[model samples]
Target: MRESYSLLPITELKGVGARLAEELEQLGIATVDDLFAYFPYRYDNYELRDLTDVQDQEQVTILGKVQSEPLLNYYGKKKSRLTVRVLSGRYLITVILFNRPYLKRSLKLEDTVTVTGKWDRNRATLTSSDFHIGQPDQNAQWAPVYPVKSGVSVKKLRVLISQAFTQFPNRIKENLPKELLTSYKLIGREQAIRTIHFPDGQANLHQARRRLVYEEFLIYQLKMQAYKRMKRSSSDGIRIPLDQKRIREFVGLLPFSMTHAQNRVIDEILKDMASSSPMNRLLQGDVGSGKTIVAAIALYAAVSAGYQGALMAPTEILAEQHAENLHNLFQPFSISVGLLTGSVRGKKRRELLENLSNGKVHILIGTHALIQPEVVFQNLGLVVTDEQHRFGVGQRGALRLKGKEPDVLYMTATPIPRTLALSVFGDMDVSTIDELPGGRKQIKTYWVQENIIDRVIQFMKKELDQGRQAYVICPLIEESEQLDVQNALDVHAQLSQALPGYTVALMHGKLTPEEKDEVMNSFKKRDDQVLVSTTVVEVGVNVPNASLMIIYDADRFGLSQLHQLRGRVGRGNAQSYCILLSDAKSETSREKMRMMTETTDGFKLSAYDLKLRGPGDFFGKKQSGLPSFKLADIVHDYRTLATARDDAARLVQSPQFWQEDRYEQLRKPLIESGLTQTLHLD
Candidate 1:
């Protein structure tokens, strides 16, 4: 019976036509099942209370008698205020409602009324959020409020959902096993959905919400666990023996010593490579922590085993940088490295493709161009992707498809919070380089206002005079009328005029790839004293001599991004400083500035960022393949998530768990929702 509802579209509901269907689709509701799943974002309680029991500014509902006639007053264009004096107990409260002039006609002197709104005690005013001509029914006190768009009113949604419940009676079957549901003390699926939309009271609301949240988390965790198992048994992975002698020689060839953290991570990667199952791991390290060298060693291990390697980066600049570094590192061993980007075209591109296909190129590094149709490898064994969040799951999966079950390594500079890792990248094993290399001093950070801009410029001039380059970063490329913040162009112009002889170069997203490279090269060679840019220099553009980073309107950027920008400096041995320029008056902005100066730990900053922005805005966009949960919050509902994960792990390992009748309802989502088809879940 529940399966039948999945096939019924929203148009089947009364009063829902083509236009209304399109509006409902905007809220992710296409079918009757979807409408049932669209839970309310919040609930408004209108339980009646006495005037004496109400606190100042509390949203309260009180039954009263109108003491005077409702006075209607017209104000500014199309605006009106309706005021009525209501007597409740010993107090006479003024019930004020805005833009509700029609209410004045129905309200008469000495009439019984019920009003729900904010109570201002000092002024004896009840600013009406909602009102009833008489006492409202007890069951209608708790009103569910959904997130809606224009032309789709909350009243209309309530009507549609109520009709769905009446038309499809007892059709929502339970998806969880009987034993599991009883153990967890969860309500039935149908009751949970019904109570969540038209909740009876606080207790039932909590119970219903808990059931829905647990179910969402459980399904997501099951998907992840199934995907992980599929990767492990999908095919036989390349069992490459660890070449200790070659790795040791490469390490010895380097001018600097590897940190314990880097060495430990390398050991983990090598272990995964030597296993029969393919390696699906995420490598996390702060900027300039020698992650590249660790990746280099892994690439070396694959190439020495007579299989090709590929490193995919989000941008061409990072890819080219890896190409140059890998070419230099592998030159002593006589292993060839090839670079393929969008600019590498015509005959050169053809030659590179031929070399990669025939095994002449031992290591191939490029951007998205590496995933094209013509690009093929002789024996691709390992894949490493830089800044894994920039690319969606499809992009990453596309690169993996290029090889025959290649061991994949995803590297990121932004440290994902542990809770987020469990939800987003839960399928992959995680390896973190917690320690920075020796001899690198911690970057000194400070937050300041725009009034002291001249002093900050003077400090930058001193750094420039010491033969150290600096970066002046802004949040925007050009001036924005909406936001009165500093931009790259204006900052570049101001810095040029402020400092007489220093060359202030500009870089932003508007520039061509070649132009960006040229400007970055000039700064790298100390030809430009100041490089003013946007967040484009946030990753992979490393200059060892740059000692100062001044971020304008720093409050506008998130904590993780600010940390990435700070990482641009402090690459060299000399003492580095990051001066954040902002005069934001909000407490949240001030807190962001304070935290930026408190610690340089990327993991700590990322956790705080996740807390401040939630998961939706944490990645600056909706991350691909990250579950869009309706009721479960990874940050707040972490304990519930952990429980769901544990339950799912146990269920997946159970023999014939998918085929059992007790688990039959669970298979509907896994199969009908395309989880089985996409991940090939058994």
Candidate 2:
């Protein structure tokens, strides 16, 4: 019954003919409720101003009579500009337009017109892209400006939104219980939508945004709590008891002492694995943190209990590195490690698969190929996914299904804020390794402008002359169909031409698995070489001697990716440096550069990145398994998010919300509006 309005197609509304219906379809608005959910991206304040009071270079709106007919001037075949001279009593102002010749017909001599644009004193003209034929609207506070496609106009959307509201004024239903809204001081869903689309003033808009943010966050928190409950009460898991003797030998082989942070996280993982319920834990450590050693400890304990362990990485290169490192870690303890990826072929692949199925291989490390259907496990009791954000929920689940609900440990180098951790990964037990291994030095980072490019190159040359390796990271961007981004290929060519004696290697997503492995291996061996690549090198390329890290157009990278790229360099004991080259003149871009230079703390950087860029950019599309909320900015409304999470945890704890028939209606609506089914939380 609650889905009736949302079920109706947008074509049923008035003024939505076939042509308009096709236009709306392009925006993913096929239903009546979809049109309503299309909120404004910004607002336009229509403040009326007197012509005499207009200041220089100010965006103002003035009403006056047209003194002369509009004149159109042309530069070339398709180039033109418009001018309309206006007079308000004794004051006079010339209005200029850039490309809108269509507005020429709307002007009539001596007709009162309202012009809204920037006022320039030097030219004594107002540069306007917007003007109308009506008198100035003194009472009009603001207007909703929505995002539109090619065929749709802002005026057309305004008309359609009004029609939708008129047709379904009272039909727009609220999903939250009335008491919940009253207790939390949140407005009803219908009122929130109305005020958001057609806000009366700033205060009303603020209230409208508050209500929507709460709703978006609440839905996400509910899913988190639901998954948490499932993990706790269910017993379909293998209990891997702690092995003190085996663990002692495993850590004894390490070259350095373990940090207190690492020890604490290992204990948490051990507790979860020893339980009856399945263990879904997230282990996050800063770059070079001893997360790998902790994971090895868990694998060792799992193997001691006669259970096979599988570790999945996002990239083939990373998978290979893990196999090598893990093999070394378990060599003295006589634990066998197998490597499986798409690159393995013919007899080698068959041998690994047979060994894995027959329980000969104690631990398996590979890329997404580990989740394939034919990859059977003998006694897979534990599945550890490194950099878990790189895989989707389905990929993680497929690996777990190899053995009935194997205990899952998700590891990541990307650090997020604690509030965000509580909101997004609430379903999983979280453990953090904040301390780096002893003897590692903090990376010296600098944000360089383009004018000093030559000087920066010389510094890198000095590093190379000193027998140290360096990494030059290119920006990853795709602006439009007609424009190609400056990717690794272009940068590699330029760098090869600029640096004569040094060997420069190229690697990116377009390279084949064998090609990437070959290039990475070559880069690792050559001390005088520089690897010019993209973010593909962010995770797996770990050469300790590689001390210099330079990212071109560094402003294009988010704080997290930039931090991960920096992590690639400082993995060794030698003093390291990260240089960011950005010529961007924007304040936001410069601010990010400043933040990078000030600190190397991933947690603090992530929290700042959340505030600088919204949650969408923080988790991108394919990575970070989290589906972004449409309206919730994790930075601004953090307090609201905390409240929502607490309320959801409380509500889902008791059986009354799920068992009572009255509250069942509320649960279904909220779940359906979000990506509950996509993440397999259900």
Candidate 3:
């Protein structure tokens, strides 16, 4: 039978059998292509070294003769050791392998072998546990380190990978044009793959990385360009011609005057509404920047023009919050409003659908459930999405499809850097709400040590005694039973004991949705004097009466998260405070914590975070399902990404490239990588 590329089991390879194939499959290596893309996380260099040149603490491979038989020693109930002596003519050194008496039988006195490991020096004597004895010139030079699981060793995986690479067919097509390679001074694909696996030198590795990084970013830029072109060509809903009088009247009725930044963004959105094409825009602002009010004005414009509008939030609580806020704001204007979410069921949901279909609901607010097939709109004109980063591009597209080519306004509270915004959201027009609403007080933030817990509690009690509310945030829901930090349940217990007179309520993810809602509702009504909870309350549970927020283990959270938590307080007329508690002693950790104390500006905090911890660490691995780039450091390589974006725009503008066969191979890898999904193309 002819061997198939995928149908043949992995055991068909030289050293693999059914059992080994199953083991390889457990590592997500089922086919040749999967193995090829599974790049090493890091490499260990094992270049040969002479015995005379072996230095302490340096990882080296040296060949020496065993001068004495290994000796075994046992000192404690659980401790055992094996000691071997190695000699190189005039010099001698003792090699100690701890807790492995079997090594005494594995090696003979006169045996000559090569050992690979790092040499350690203690009181002028060198020692190392990171050593492995092997035959000279047979072991790997630059060993690839894979993330090992149970029953797997780095050495064993290295052997398997080396064998796989040898037997695997070189089927990768050259996707980058030769001209671009020459212009960018990038290595070829074949060279990059080989050098990345077994680099001859640091310079070669760097060159390989540069080529790969550029390719990754280049594809991303290409997709953005395609999306931009596609959006420009798509048909738009009827433009709601701007009515300055109506807008001004709405602005006059607002409780506070619009900030200069808010007015600018409003003007930008108005211009988009009056344009010939649908608006694909993003409204980025810090927490409490009044983006909702601006969205309301846009919705009013759409409704006044005899069209409908919709707003989508990431969570049901946030969606409900938006609906309530909009309903209250539009109440005086007599504008109809409706709310729909997954939790809304039975007759209410059916009635909402009927109202939305009949255009009785001028503005609609809901979670992703609003995009369901049953929910349809009459002449939907504008779509606004809150916390846009929380939803994927596909989800946004699904929501947009609810309307007839409706204008889109995506909003994010997390302030993305200008460079990153350009790279990530390049296809969309960007507007930032850089100003806070008038009369809004800046939150006073402080970092405290654990020893100040009593003082903090006393302050909270004082606030509660004054008829104000407070929120105490814990990192975990239940007591971990193992970890030393406070949890929601434990904090609730302690606080209940500490403040016997105040009513304390606890909420966490472990609670059922109904239970969570009950707790949140009780806290919102100020029925509970103190609310102790986990990060479940992080996004959209607003309690204007809550004047203080105390977050334990504040060092465990990212800067953006810290800012979001701080935003939970300082929403009402009260002078609010946020206390961050941490036990960290490192200066870096202190400085990171201090960023919150120094500023309440989300953008400024993000900038500081980007500097302190690079973008990769800020979001962490598997952050929101963003594509992980093997080569590009989004923080450090901003200039390169910008250049790539510009180049992609220019290249895509050439109709010949999009129409010609020349770019087919160039676009194939991008499609295969699943990065093109963001572009809304097949």
Candidate 4:
């Protein structure tokens, strides 16, 4: 019976015809089981309350008697107003509803009813959102509100869900082991599925939600654990011999001193290098925090041990930057460094590939070109990916496969919150470089409206006149009708006209790699005093002489991105400045600007950004490898996530747990959720 119902189509349900079925399919509900799994985003608390106790604009439910008949009046086209007067205690409250004229029948005179909505204090009215003909029981006070589309209304979905419950009882099978259920004090899967929709009582709803959320997090953590296990097993962990004296010599050769944070992270990385298990670590540091030096140290260690090392970047310019910096750093030791990018073609590319394959290139750096089929490595021991979030898992995985159990280091300049890191990069151990190097002055940041442009230009001219360069970043390369923000071309033209004496150049993502490199080279050499570009220079175009950054439409970007752009400056000895230009009316946008002015802490800004824009949008959702759980939220349910991670680690260690009869139900869902491709579930 359960199997039959699980396969039952939406059309088989009474009153669900073709159009409604199409709408249901839009919500990813095709079969009965899918509908059962579709949980509500939130619930309306229609618990009974007093009219006098309601605050202004507060959603409250009042049990009252209808003092007057509901008057239905037509307003604009397809719009109707239904008004009624309800008597509760000694107060007569006007109940206003919109476009729900059919509800007039339920608001008859002298009838006791329950109304739920926002209370408008000025109008002395209760704008009713939902109502019941009679006072519902305590268990029925909470109403489920599912995420709906244009054609599928919440009321209709509720009816269909209720019908599904009645038609498909006992269809939900218990997937969790009895030990887990007892240990967590969780309800059964069948009860959870049933109560999550109708919600019999508050206690039952809490228990049901807990069970479902735990299951979602547990399964996600299990997938992460499985991937971690696959990563360890696929590579024969070759422990790199760590010579502390050689490493100290390399560090001593550097011109500058390393921060305590850098030293700590390097210690962690070296420890991982010496371990038999492959090093799967994420190196997260703020912009200009000297992540490159740490990566250079790790590469030095790998190469000194008679093995090749490769570093991958997201963009050609960033790749070139790494190659240039590493070339200068490794020159003392005579360690060969090679560059491979989209533009390095024909003879040069072939020669580079040959050197790479023959182990002549001790340290190789490039964009995605490094992961191509032909770029073979003779002894690829270490793999480093700069700005790792920009590359997808498959790209990184492909590069790792080129070597025999290479130690992999994923580096990101964008600071991620620790909890977010655990959820997204849970497969890898995380190391953070929290402190900036000594004597690096903080960039003075300011937010200004677009109206104060002349003053900002004067300040820019003063800074440029003193032999400093400036970076002007726009959100768009070309003019966008949909967005009111300034484009690169317009900003370039404006800046050129304003600063006629200074050499102003333009760069954007639309430009070719050679063109971008040419423009960047000009800027680096101080030939261009002002460089107008898009977010292309947000990553790794380092120019120490440039000290001023003016960002237009700063509110259009996330806080982390704005920080990254700001980081382009303040890399030199002199003090730097960043001016944010926005005429944003929203408080959220204004708050972002204010926060940027408040502190230079990237981790704090990232945590706030994670809350403002969820984990999916923090980085690109498709490439993040973070799961889209229906009931579990990684931010709010982090404790639950941690517990689930521990449980998953324990469960995965049990050999062939997927094949055991006790976990048969669990394994079916894991495969169905698309873990079979990554995990050896068989």
The TM-scores of all predictions, comma-separated, are 0.89, 0.82, 0.79, 0.85
lDDT (CA) for every model shown?
0.88, 0.83, 0.78, 0.87
Ranking by TM-score: 1, 4, 2, 3
Candidate 4 clash pair list? none
Model 3: clashing residue pairs? 57-119
Model 4 residue 223 CA deviation (Å) reads 2.9
Rank list by lDDT: 1, 4, 2, 3
Per-residue lDDT tens digits of candidate 4, residues 437-480? Answer: 88889899999999999999999999998999999999999988
Please give the RMSD of candidate 4 to the true structure.
Answer: 4.4
Comparison by lDDT, 1 against 3, better one: 1
- The deviation in Å at residue 36 for candidate 1 is 3.2
- Candidate 1: tens digits of C-alpha lDDT, residues 545-623: 9999999999999999999999998887899999999997999999999999999999889888988998878864554
Taking all chains together, the TM-score of candidate 2 against the true structure is 0.82
lDDT of 3 by residue, 1-682 (tens): 0111223446656777777667777887776555555567787776766656666677666667888888899988978877778874455777766787777778887787666656654422335445555555543566677776756567777676567668764554566777788898888876787677667666888898888788878888887776676666555555777777987898998888888999999999999998867899989998989888899999998887788999999877788788888899989888898988877889988898998899888898988887788988988989999988777677888989987778999888888777677766777888998878878788889899999999999888888888899989899876676766778888899999999888999988877766877888888987888989888778867788889999998887778888998899998998999999898678877887888898888998887777777766654434343456766877778778877888787766765554445666665554554434334322
TM accuracy, model 1: 0.89
| Sequence-dependent TM-score of model 3 | 0.79
